[model samples]
Target: MKPRSLVSQSPTSLKLTTGCEALDACLRGGFPCNSLTEIVAESGCGKTQLCLQLSLRAQLPISNGGLNGSSLYLHSELPFPFRRLHQLSKSFHLSNPNIYADHNDNPCDHVFVQNVHSVDHLLDVMPKIDSFVKSSRTRLPLKLIVLDSVAALFRSEFENTPGDLRKRSSLFFKVSGKLKRLADRFGLVVVITNQVTDFVESSDGLSGLRIGNLRGLYSSGRRVVPALGLAWANCVNSRVFISRSGDGICEERREDDESGSSSVGRRDRRRFDIVFSPYLPASSCEFVITREGICGVG
Candidate 1:
């Protein structure tokens, strides 16, 4: 007889709060544990901010809308934004005093960051994270893993090569499988940020009519789609997109210390669209980024 498998095969619904109320609502509680969630957005649209916020939120106990664990953040293209994470940690600590009452203990200490310069480095480091998660005996268990800008590593190496397509596709499956396995085995919420590529109409003039960069992720006459093609899309369980409004004007809320002018910052209108997901609806929500965090559009 063959040896029995050790890992659990069933899926889980337990989630970690994203820490942003509007984003959490959009995700229907939070990012689902034991699954991979992808966040795709244009530059300067708060992808890293959201990731940073989630790192802090994941540290919250289960009763307080958290996974009661720590997070692993892997960045390939950009340096980890420490200032923003610290700012958000300050706010998060103030709100959840019970969990972070100690003034000396920093919330950021719970988040483990790994910066990978190349794809091979990333592939190598991921398995080590699995090892840490499995052997971790700390009070806070490992709960989340974040890869900011997943496509950048491939886009540079692949360089629009047809042969590299197969290679890229293979790497996609391999990395995603590793993450998925870890998620199922230890119930980790995997979040990956992907870059975008302009969806070019390549019908070779067979059709006269054009649909304005029609693509699978876009809705109602849209342009540009998430990069890394279908293989990457299939690997992730959920895809949440963020885009800035044409005007890029976010609402201004009054603060006690600041005057009306000081309160009003360049708060751009951002749309959080759930392009596709098994549990989440094919819907979108409006939200803005502030010093506090992601807030409702209203």
Candidate 2:
């Protein structure tokens, strides 16, 4: 019998492009497979937008920086934004026509959207995902699994009591372990979104800042920390942050300036930061959300 080679057994080397050149470069190719990546940010900071773009891009061929597979999006927030996804798919398919020439087919159809109600609901659903991935019903191989927002699942379910906190932490490990296992076993890229909470300073005025990294997290002119606290933070393999500044100038600065732009109105300037990652150094880049999709701004 032939022996298995190291390269053939290792799945961690694979990656899925984020569909943006600048953001891809910052992430050292893109979100790595065989790992659990947490995208953290405040509301309306383009977290879901990025995840939606990734779901579409994951369907492209590997040569084009895609996994040539399907994605499972488990949303715990608002109803799955099918309308927004339709818009993104139209632009994505148009941009990559060589591979999508017969683009009459809808890409959104390939993305499976599931609504998760709460922590208990998610736990019940977690074990079934393994079977879903192996089933022959799916048209394409599953390469990515996205949980729209992990924070929402556990947000109001737990109290400040020690027993409740410990239980919540245990659940965090269970969910993360299953996600990481799926990623490792199937070479799937798991990306989970996390909401943020206000960062209140302690008596010494510095304890809160030490949560994830030395710099700390701030967004929209206010200091905030990723929800679910430190116990949950330690579960994921990587953490990425997206922040929005409300006073940002429009993407077309020259046009806005020339139009004497009070009528132009300001847009939020969003930034993506690699808070911590085993394969990447801490870094960030500015990005914008447009009709096409989310893209890095140089």
Candidate 3:
């Protein structure tokens, strides 16, 4: 019998670059492919915007620390923000038509966007997503798969009734398991956005009542929240919390004072906190959304 070559048994790893030099350096590359990443935050926290930027960045060539593949943006609550995507693309100076163009010569040919409002619709579209990955021949890899706000589908579909708590939790476990398998088979970075729910004390005092806060309210009482609870956090490899800080005015004044000067001035800052990670930095960094690209705001 012939001996197996060492190369045949070795496992290869895919590491994506985040497009932010500092962040990429800290991550030792970017998000790992074939893994699930969670980004959680409240409304107006710039989670969606960061996801959009990452989606665009994932299509660059490998020399530039990208997979040069297509991105699938699955928006559960809203339409695709095409204008924001275009603006970011222009700012990054990502002018490679081969990376963005389709067979028919469209600029955004590689970017696929879908809005899924219902859990049933999401399930129905599973096969299509798989087909896209398989048909791409893995040469033009499917770099990223994003589910913007997974909590929406669960909250709307499950309702988190007292009687259905066990059933709903079981269903979420199954769904999350399938998502993990999908990421492994396709060699893509799977990103899921989640909304937080308040943990309240229960009448029995043994366990607490969990309330979904999609609109940022905890008034309507529910026995359990529909967000898959702790299981959701455990299923993903990393989690990022994005939030806004400081008014834009402070930076405006600094910019005005530093006009015609080359010194770096105060700028409106957005925070990207690495809240959870298995192998990355845990510190928060300030950044600014610019007409060109996302830059560190010192």
What's the TM-score of every candidate structure? 0.84, 0.89, 0.76
lDDT of each: 0.78, 0.84, 0.67
Model 2, position 296, has a per-residue lDDT of 73
lDDT of 3 by residue, 115-159 (tens): 888767887777788887787764456778889988888876665
Instruction: Indicate which candidate wins on TM-score.
Output: 2
For candidate 2, what is the lDDT?
0.84
- Give the clashing residue pairs of candidate 3, or none: 91-292
Candidate 1: lDDT of 198? 63
Error of 2 at 23 (Å): 0.6
lDDT of 1 by residue, 259-297 (tens): 655643434657788877888766777777889887775
Candidate 1, superposed: residue stretches over 4 Å from native: 1-12, 102-104, 204-222, 248-267
- Candidate 1 whole-model C-alpha lDDT, 0 to 1: 0.78
* Top lDDT hit: 2
The true-versus-predicted C-alpha distance at residue 202 of model 1, in Å, is: 1.8
